[model samples]
Target: MHPPAHGADTPLFIVLNAASGRRDTDAVRTAIESACNAAGRRCRIFLVDGPGKLQPFAREAVERARAGGGVVVAAGGDGTINAVAQATLGSGCAFGVLPQGTFNYFSRTHGIPAETEAALQVLLTEPPRAVQVGLVNDKVFLVNASLGLYARLLEERETFKRDYGRSRITALGAAVVTMLRGGHRSWRLRLAWRGQERDLRTRSLFVGNNALQLHQVGIADADAPEEGQLAAIAVKPGRWWSLPGLLVQGALGRLGHADDILSFPFASMTVKPAASGQRRIKVATDGELNWLAMPLLFRVAPEPLWLIKPAVAPELEAARE
Candidate 1:
């Protein structure tokens, strides 16, 4: 493999989100500082104390990375990682992750360790490798992006997490509660992809850019993301009730076998919400909700994440999974 973009001597600009994950900020900060000091590597920790500060801090970290040939590292959940990645995507600087998220799918999928010490070791020593990214309009998503019912579900999921605490069980419970509450809204969507245009109705749309997630969810063509493409799953119109069943199948790792589910792989797609004068819509990218302009264009990002991670064969990913 090519030599790692940065060496052990490169400085690190870590953007730490105090709100992400369940870890104690003071403890994590101390660990980061101790590790960097021991390695004799320059490390700067930019604390993101609020949502409003994430983008600004990330931009500042990117500037630092550019100035010192340092690596910009995100030290938080997927949302925090997404924020940092938005700034680093095309900045010609390498990016790193210190996964402290409940899922940490992006980091675990790349073989980054969960322990703070191990993660810092990789950040300080590993080479940079390309990882696929998905885009919804201008927003960058590392794992997945969604809209309609799924987007609303994410909003509800956050509320549930705050009350019930963060866990896989809590997430599943949120899904069950959201479904049982019965707010399924269908939309007439015009989808144009691969030079073909088709109209369809669906209650939710999810686009996945992480092959590891697609595979874990039992979506066929799970390798699409690794092949410079994206995989999408849509809830068929009038079949919103089937979502619960699909969710169960997903938990069982057999979601692709279900009927009334629409799944496909595409390099690019244009989705027009067939509503009159509705240009703004809510989208959830990597679990962060935002109001994005309509005619959502889902495509593979022009650039890849320069992730500092370990190399492993695809079949060996079972351990990481």
Candidate 2:
């Protein structure tokens, strides 16, 4: 797929999730409307009021953008961006993001501003650039995907988010509580990658697609994703008391030196649950939860999403001129 070559007059089909970030939805809508008026571009807003509405809105955005040579923009967090990107992947339309998520890993990794105000400006003025996306059972994930204990952690985090609100600190607290009280049992699974298959016991299996995230977590081969490969990390069985130390190591960017962590960089991986009858399992992609049929496949997507990158700095452009 190629980038959409439309100018300022190109319409913007926006998918905005109402509950995504800390920003007021009405304020965001007003800001976008005002910006579109100033730029003399059409802004069509598709409000995602619920999770079930996201796919329909994303599909609508892709369709409208493709029909009118416009750009499909997602104004939310990483999960929202992932959903919209899934729709725009092969539609030959450009994708834009207004980062409003807690982590905003996908936006941060690509040099997009985390603030909604600055991100809005870039979404409007920047040109589309081809960017890599990872696939889990054909579902697009821009940051990371995980199974087993980590997916359960996300569920616990959501419950805490509902009670205490959303933030990085809240997420950490949730993780701590979940690990302290939740089950510490390992999963019996089979992994097939790089022409070899192995059965292993793990508490969590995480596949990372964003280089910045992996690097921040102290993965030695984090750059593998940028080089057209995905990075996998399996949490080996260890005492429950050791999990906190590993978490601290991860936060300190020293997880690469940990003994309980196993990392692999590969082109693709096929994962199967312990029994054939266990056909479906819970998975989390970019922090969104779902149940998918196994054996799960993780790899780089064949097509690229045309992402509108940051515009060149005005001073640099002026110097060139």
State the lDDT of candidate 1 residue by residue for 1-321, as single tens digits.
232358878999999999888899999999999999999999999998876899999999999999999899999999999999999988888899999889888887788888898888888777998888889997999999998888998999999999999888899899988877776888788899999988889888899887778888788878888789999898886555667887898888788887767899999999996666878889999999999988899999877778888886343267225
Candidate 1: which stretches are off by over 4 Å? 1-5, 313-316, 319-321
TM-score of each: 0.95, 0.94
Worst lDDT 10-window in candidate 2: 312-321
Best-fitting candidate, scored by TM-score: 1
> Which residue pairs in model 1 clash with each other?
none
* Candidate 2 residue-wise lDDT, 122-195, digit = tens: 88788898888899999888999999888989989999999999999999999988888746779889999989
Question: Model 1: which ten-residue window has the lowest total lDDT?
Answer: 312-321
Error of 1 at 17 (Å): 1.0
Query: So what's the TM-score on candidate 2?
Result: 0.94
TM-score of decoy 1? 0.95
